[model samples]
Target: MAEWIYEDGIGEARAALIEDGVIVAAEIEADDDGIAAGTIAEGRLVKITVPGRRGLVRLDGGEEVQIEPLPRGVTEGGRLVVEIRRAALPEPGRAKLALARQASPEAGIAQGPTLIERLHASGDAVRRLMAHEADALEAAGWSELLEEARTGEVAFPGGGLRLSLTPAMTLIDVDGWLDPAALSIAGAEAAARMIVRHGIGGSIGIDLPTAGSKAARQAAAEAVDTIVPQPFERTAVNGFGFLQIVRRRLRASLPERLQGDPLGSAARALLRRAERTPGSGMRTISSHPGVIGRIADRPDWQAELARRIGAPIALRPDARLAISGGHVDAENP
Candidate 1:
């Protein structure tokens, strides 16, 4: 049976769906993910950007979001309850605001369900992991999966996929030593698996090896269908071997979270390592200066880590080390 292995790490909550001892899907919910979808809150209409179609709202917490289908009688400065449809997405230069719509007053103000709650709702067996227990997550290639998201590189049997995130959509290029027909089939399947694993949604463009025959193109498209379960729409493979897919996007994908905020991701990863470090007295975390700075900026996270491990935590900055090259050392007192 497929199971979800869950860990409540210091700064993030992680879950991995394991089937046959391999991770098929994964999710990471950081503490800073603002105004998650399904959240119901009261906010004041701040500005009417699109007249009656859309407007901006300022929540009680001072975060602004875009709301659509403005109520007929509600004008600027009117207070109303809103339900978040999509959480804010972090991008390279600018972040997208959360999207919401007016909600009934009966909905009441409530926070969104957490990562663990959503997993439990899936009807799958969930195993909550403790830090002191054997590292089941690591054994399931959690670190390797994370590296793939950070770099957007996935290697399969016959070829590899290079995924690039664009403002319009995610573009995937397949390349390998195999022949065009075989490579197209293999690459399509591999790309599909990566999309599900990374929780990637929205628009996607897959560029496979150009197939000369219509039958070859159909085979490649079928390969993708077999891997990715539906609720998505896809265009038929064209003569040039290009296929496009559209999926419902409610939040940022794993790649976006890791790539958009490298220092925060690295800092949280380092804390996870520190929590699991054995024979700890004063655990020292050594990493790039930027990562160390990120951790230092959040003293609450450090205190939480120290509390969980029952040991003091120290930060050691090494400018020469790569961002993801951080390590944890437990002092023997």
Candidate 2:
């Protein structure tokens, strides 16, 4: 049965839509993700970056975001209301500012819908998961799905895809030992699945094996249509076996989160595993120093883990371990 599995984890909320026992779509909402999309706030116009076109606004909470269509006569230092269009996106070295537009003066201040709320609003059966519930997310290949996003690798029958994120767009390069015609079709299908699974948006380019004939290219395009849902635009496969797709990007994708904050991502994953580890008494979480540092910086998360598992929690930084190579060990009190 198709359903959404939701978990309010230690540092983040997660949801996965399962169809035929496979994850077709998923989302991870970090607790620290600032002002979600659709939030309306009053802020001061701190700077007129683009004069009449755009500017920067500092919300009452002190977060600065880029606002478009700088309302007529609204100059620097002016107070105005704006609705968030998208949350800030985390990147490797820096983060993109959240996007907003002027809001009606009479609009009521509101927070955006949460991941679980969105799932319920979808009218699909949503099953809230608990720590002791057999780990339905993992059983549905959540870890493997995350690895694929982190590594940008997805394998199919005849070929595999190598996805790379760039400033302008995400690129998917297909490679394998299949024939040109067959490989293009297979690659397109795989790329489409990856796009939907990861919630990849904005611009995307897929490079498939060059088609031997125009018919082959059409077949490849048809393959993509079979998997990806509507509300997107794509170009027909060009002679160079390239296709471009554009989707509305309202928030950061899975890859952006995992790659943008490696230490935090690893730390949270370690904490989740620790919470689920079966034992009593004290539990020790051992990981790379950076990950341990990240966890240490968030004592609240550690306390929550301890509270949930009914045990004392300890952290040990091992220089020899990789960031994601953390393990939990239960010790006698």
Candidate 3:
């Protein structure tokens, strides 16, 4: 049976779905950041892009969503109610939000169980962790996963694949190795695991070396189906060894979230460091200036981390440090 491990930190809340003692899914949320998605709000229509394609709706709290299927009879500067289907990812500025449905003006704040809560309510045996489950998350080289997710360059057992993000789809280029059939099979399996590990979804295109037979191509495509989760559509490998797959996208993929912000990923890395450290008094995570700035901005997160670790948490901004390179050290109280 699968067990759910949940950790409620001072500033961050994390949940992991562990099946057979291996973590299959993980989620994290910060207290300082407002819930990104699954919220309904009242807003005012600000602008309409074209006649019926998309419209900008500003919520009462000043957030805005580019609502699609443009609401009927809605004009400029009109009262609008919408449910935020997708939350804006954390970026330099406002994130583009996708609205799902029209809501009534009387709808209050969207309420729903958190990731961990939802998992518990699903009738699974849930276990609450007194501390962060870094060990479980660290399985199979955590650093490598984070780095790969950030770079979108992944290597298979005998080959490699580079994933490129386009506005329309994620294009993957597979190379290395001599056997086309073996390479295609390897690429398909690796890509499927990477997609799940990196939380990749939506449209995907894989370009493999031209195979000799349609049977070989079909076999490769089947490998992907066997590994990847359901509710996704895939096309058979073409003559040129091209396969297109589409999956439902819910949240920002790890690659998409950390593409431009290495320090953001670094900050989370430091949190994992704190989690792994055994003894702690005043735990200080010295990081790059940008990373420090982000952590400092979230006092609630700092407090939460401190409380969870039973120590004072300090974030030191060292301009000399690289974003991805930092040390988590403990000081005597």
Candidate 4:
């Protein structure tokens, strides 16, 4: 047997079911003739059964609610779409309230705890404190950094090479002031090390101080490989004698976190708006958090419908109002 507790919020309904000493489902709550606590039925996307009562709820992707039960005093076939949030609360408060109401109100009033008091009361407060601290530690693991490119001629500590960076590519121009010394292989090695350590990704062009002989260019290329341990299939000195570096994306780069594609979120709005129009042939393209938020908070969505249909729109949460045109693909988000 199962027990279902129904809660109606500003625009939704949420139900919680407890069974076998555990909460089976408490997130999505729906009210339909076919739903109860013990058995899963068709149209019942989510279900759970308790010792005596059963519960079921529907979800509309994110937060926008499409359908819910009529509030008390509002008869069936009523019009109104409500959104609700459901979660577990401590049971001690329910018991205390029951006992107080049963006992003499005047006598029990001073003895019983407040509703908020019961919700927060815990047998082990230390555990709750430790969990909060652990959450902070988990959040600290994520890290990121951004490096700005040099704008003008920048001097190296040894005054032998120079590097410049722009939005398109990084330019490494060498002066070779060291007595035309057979291309200091060690200096090229040091430059390569800095590039790898800085985590530079994308195209890099290296100018090797205008080497007099092909052997000097080859020596500089070999030195770069020795200093940088990156796996290379082949390092071919191009016609211009510049080393074209194609470094693999070594880490979970910064831009990956900053940019992303879009997604959908309003199944209810799509369904209702399409239903409101006649022969408009509208369909739910996608459902996303942003669309759901707009649906829940916005006072009216008929304007959105009208925009699509090129005419005035009619929207009624009341079941009596029939929908005519659009199709709603309600996702289980």
TM-score of each: 0.95, 0.97, 0.85, 0.29
Instruction: For residues 203-242, write the lDDT of model 2, one tens digit per residue.
Output: 9999999988999999999988888888899999999999
lDDT of 2: 0.92
Taken over the whole model, the C-alpha lDDT of each candidate is 0.92, 0.92, 0.72, 0.34
Which has the better lDDT: candidate 1, or candidate 3? 1
Clashing pairs in 3: 10-304, 11-304, 36-87
In model 2, residue pairs whose N, Cα or C atoms come closer than 3 Å (at least 3 residues apart or on different chains), thus clashing, are none
- Give the better candidate number (1 or 4) by lDDT: 1
Total backbone collisions for each predicted model: 0, 0, 3, 26
Off by over 4 Å in 1: 69-71, 104-106
* Model 1 C-alpha lDDT per residue in residues 1-333, reported as the tens digit of each score: 899999999889999999988999999999888888899999999999998799999999888999998877889999999999888987877778999999976798999888999999989999999988998889989999999989999999988999898989998899998999889889999999999999999999999999888888999899888988888999999999999999888788899889888888999999998888888599999999999999999999999998998889899999999999999998973
Superposed on all Cα atoms, model 3 deviates from the true structure by an RMSD in Å of 3.2
Alpha-carbon runs more than 4 Å astray in model 4 = 1-161, 166-168, 181-187, 238-240, 250-333
Q: Model 1 residue 96 lDDT?
A: 83
Worst 10 residues of 1 by lDDT: 87-96
Q: Provide the global lDDT of candidate 4 against the true structure.
A: 0.34
